[model samples]
Target: MTSPTPQAPVRRPTAADGFVVVDKPQGWTSHDVVGRLRRLAGTRKVGHAGTLDPMATGVLVLGIGKATRLLTYVVGADKDYDATVRLGVATTTDDAEGQVLSVAGPGAVEGVDRPALDAAVADLTGDIQQVPTSVSAIKVDGKRAYALARAGESVELRARPVTVSRFEVLAVRQVTATVADGGPDVPVVDIDVRVTVSSGTYVRALARDLGAALGTGGHLTALRRTRVGGYDLAGARTLDELEKQADADGTLATLPMAEAARATFPVRELDEDEVRALGYGQWVAPSGRPEVVAAISPSGELVALLEDTRRRGDDLARPVLVLAAH
Candidate 1:
């Protein structure tokens, strides 16, 4: 019997197709934004660079069509957050979302002056191992840590190395509030902090660690991501604005793939031949830079991600991601 006719390979979208930076609203999960974008863009190929907690609001880099290749690079870049940490209480999730596990009495944490807070923040800066919150998205035994914790399982995550480039206390205030159990009143000290940390670093963990250092419980009250790599809230379009633009033009507001890559990383321009070779996933000569750089064509099109690989005495460079031909 004759075999069935060979089917043609599905054609993927081109690098010209990329993502839009969105200022996600509170209570909307990252997946929710992606779903909206998929409908807005009239395409199913939509993804985000990173995941943000539902309570967090800030810049979320999205990838459209073939630009999804850029997510890997974006995900590894440094991140910045402006957050509020509430002292005098600890929670199961390390944030305002979870149940209160413990409460320090009113004025339990006095004498936490600005100087002391500054010193605490200083100690958190630089390279350190951080234990992610039990309710984090990290997977344990192929299941999300948060899922396990929610199921009443005791989760103990190991500390992982992370870099906190900056941790500054912007403001601090002490306030009184009633507990959920209708118990006696309590005093809570709220600290506003701005942090810049490497990938995988948890802002909630930072708050928890800070409280641990101060001998008082703490948890994140609010968090707003300000920056992700080169994308910042300054350039993000809100969902309402995005919907307006989509309705007005019947086309989604998307950043060009080449532009996105260049904005996020250094660029190396390639000639027509090099571009062709890259599109075919072939190797090229080193550009003398050891870092991974986005390779673009003369016409402002992203061709591939190029990086140098050294083996013995030979230095070879190759494309990590080959974008579709322009």
Candidate 2:
């Protein structure tokens, strides 16, 4: 009699099981949430999608256990934010955290008209090159730019291409301010805007660039992320709620990988034979469909992420990330 197929040893849970969409609180770093989850989930494999600065608050995507594999796909997705940009004052870091670099007196921006603001915002729409804030996470000579800046070093970063598909000014408010230089006149306008942009686009940079365009200088006063891909703050729970839930039930709420994937990508089911072929990393004949990644399944269970590949003049589909065997 043939011996039964040996079973693969079950791997220990390493806190990398599934994903959790947390409504991150302001003043907490992404790493802080990871540390809290590490203790709560009882595993050390927690990871997050995009990093939200301590001053910003909103949906923060996190991965646990095998779900960590999903982060690679999540991080590149488009992001959305609602922000408040204050004019008349420019800061060193481009946000409220930095020291005031320059201040214009009252009436500096008094005559600025709505049409001018609209045109300036329009110029920022669509594809454009943006210079990131000096205090960003970008690396400079193997050191984080923020770290270098903290050490009193001069930081200069190059511009990168980013797309701002939507930049709509929702409201505007004017405020008079006293300049640190004791200037007689200082008039500022606070513009509230909602933006939808490609990944890596900096909203702080937008405020700075917009100020430069208006010739009055501007800095971001408040920033909040509303969405990343299909994940949104609407479906996210605050860390405090998560902690309370864990205390009450001994389990943390998590979005299953399949559900999260479906929210982010198109689904493509596979039959038993196809699942078997994918188990060994083999390619199946393509269905002539055009999707970068398809959620392949067998018997109603997620199996892998498949993409079309051309081999020997035959269109074949191969696995990019395999989740389970046949």
Candidate 3:
């Protein structure tokens, strides 16, 4: 008689290197997503490119393993968001989460017509100086502005120049609603807008400024990020999906680091000897790409991220981050 023995299934490696586009759910802090991914990925090396407010949702870029070093570039990339700005009321934080600061008078929203809105949006377009809301993540005096604001301290953030690449108004609707602002109910105007701004720009502040320009108070009622640089919602996966993937297979899907680098920066291939030399922390010749470039080996592996720097009066390729030895 012949007997067969069952064998254990092979476990795939969990230590991965690449990016994960997350469709972050509302009410979850950016740090919450990072911590959850760390547990799911079975590594504490996970990091995010940018932070999203707890009320916002959509594309949140995460880096695992060696890709964590590339988050700087992603963090500075252009961003897109779909937001709703209520023009009849203002808030302490310039967002819905804060207490009502002031409310516009009756019939105040009627003056905010399409022409007026367009002109105000145009004023905000191009390069403009903007002061972030006091309840923001900006650091002041070695402490977070929000922390200070929450502790009953006045947080006065300085105005910084930021670019509003696009401020497209998708739709606008005026709604009359009741309010509990320690007074009788009043009419309100809510404007739906989509904005594309520079990395440091604040969409909530835009709503506040727009209301101020229109003689009505403003606050962001809703916000959802749709894109970050080249990454968008199309490539993003929700947290539930990630957990399901982990349950099905003891690993979460991640974009290959080499492929992610190729998609992000200019590629510069290295010969057999060059890849090996860089593996030993040696520098290569000028890549001619000027800024950072992905140094790929002949086998198509991302050896490192290289940048040209003036050393010894010569433009030489220096490793910005060494991802692999060979």
Candidate 4:
């Protein structure tokens, strides 16, 4: 009898090194999403670009493996949101997840007309100082603001400048609804808005300010992020889809590092010598522009993210982050 030949072992897929845009579901905190992705990507190196409230949903950009280093750049990108601001009621957290703090008088919400609402929203637009929501992740004296707020401690946060580039009212509806569990039905004006704001601008605060301007207590009823910088929901995938893909393939797909960088920053192609210099941690000739750029090698790999770090007489293209292995 002849001996049977041994078979080669099948290789399972591993973690990909790039970005993954997740369509975050409501009730999952940004950290929760990160934890879930850590499992799906089969790597604990996952990180998110921005924090999203647990009650809010939509575009949440996550980076896996070596791509985690790129998240710092993405964190400062502008964001777009679609939200429903409920007038005639206010909450402790400035959103539906908080306890009901106050309710407006009868007919208060109905009294707000289109012109008045538009004027109120306009006041919130442009450069303005805003106090972040009390229940926020902001650190105060080494403690998170939300932790103190939840512990019955008063948190006084300083007002910071933020820009609201677009505050468009998409729809307005008057309805009777409960803003909290086991709460009395209240008449409220729900204004659906699409807002584009600079990074760090709080949409919850916008709703609160808008309500205060209209003489009706207000809070965010619902919020969904639609875009983050050049990335949008168009490229986002649900967690369910990711799980199935990971289960079948043992890995999830991701936006390539070079492609993501090109979509975000100006491209600067490097020659063989320059690429070699970057690999050796040496500065190269400046790219003339002061802004950061994605430096690509001849073979189309993202060699490094460079910035013009030269002073008056000195010339150098400094590597902000080197993406390629040496």
Q: Scored by CA lDDT, what does every candidate get?
A: 0.86, 0.85, 0.89, 0.91
Q: What are the per-model C-alpha RMSD values against the true structure? A: 6.6, 8.1, 5.2, 4.8
Give me the runs in candidate 1 sitting further than 4 Å from their true place: 1-16, 310-313
Q: Tens-digit lDDT track for model 4 on 62-160?
A: 998898998888999999999999999989999988888889987788899999999999999999999999998899999999999999999999999
- Candidate 1 lowest-lDDT run of ten: 8-17
Better of 2 and 4 by TM-score: 4
Clashing pairs in 4: none
Q: Native-vs-model 4 lDDT?
A: 0.91
Q: Which model, 2 or 3, shows the larger lDDT? A: 3
lDDT accuracy of residue 290 in candidate 2: 75
Clashes of each: 0, 12, 0, 0
lDDT of 2 at 311: 88
lDDT of 2 by residue, 191-304 (tens): 999999998999999999999898888999899999999999888988888878777766776787778778777788778888888888888877566775655565566678
**Candidate 3 collision pairs:** none
lDDT for each residue of candidate 3 in 85-133, tens digit (9 for 90 to 100): 9998998889989988888887788777889989999999989999998
Tell me, by lDDT, which candidate is best.
4
Model 3's alpha-carbon lDDT is 0.89
lDDT string for model 1 (298-317, tens) is 88888888899865677777
Measured with C-alpha atoms, the lDDT of residue 299 in candidate 2 is: 52
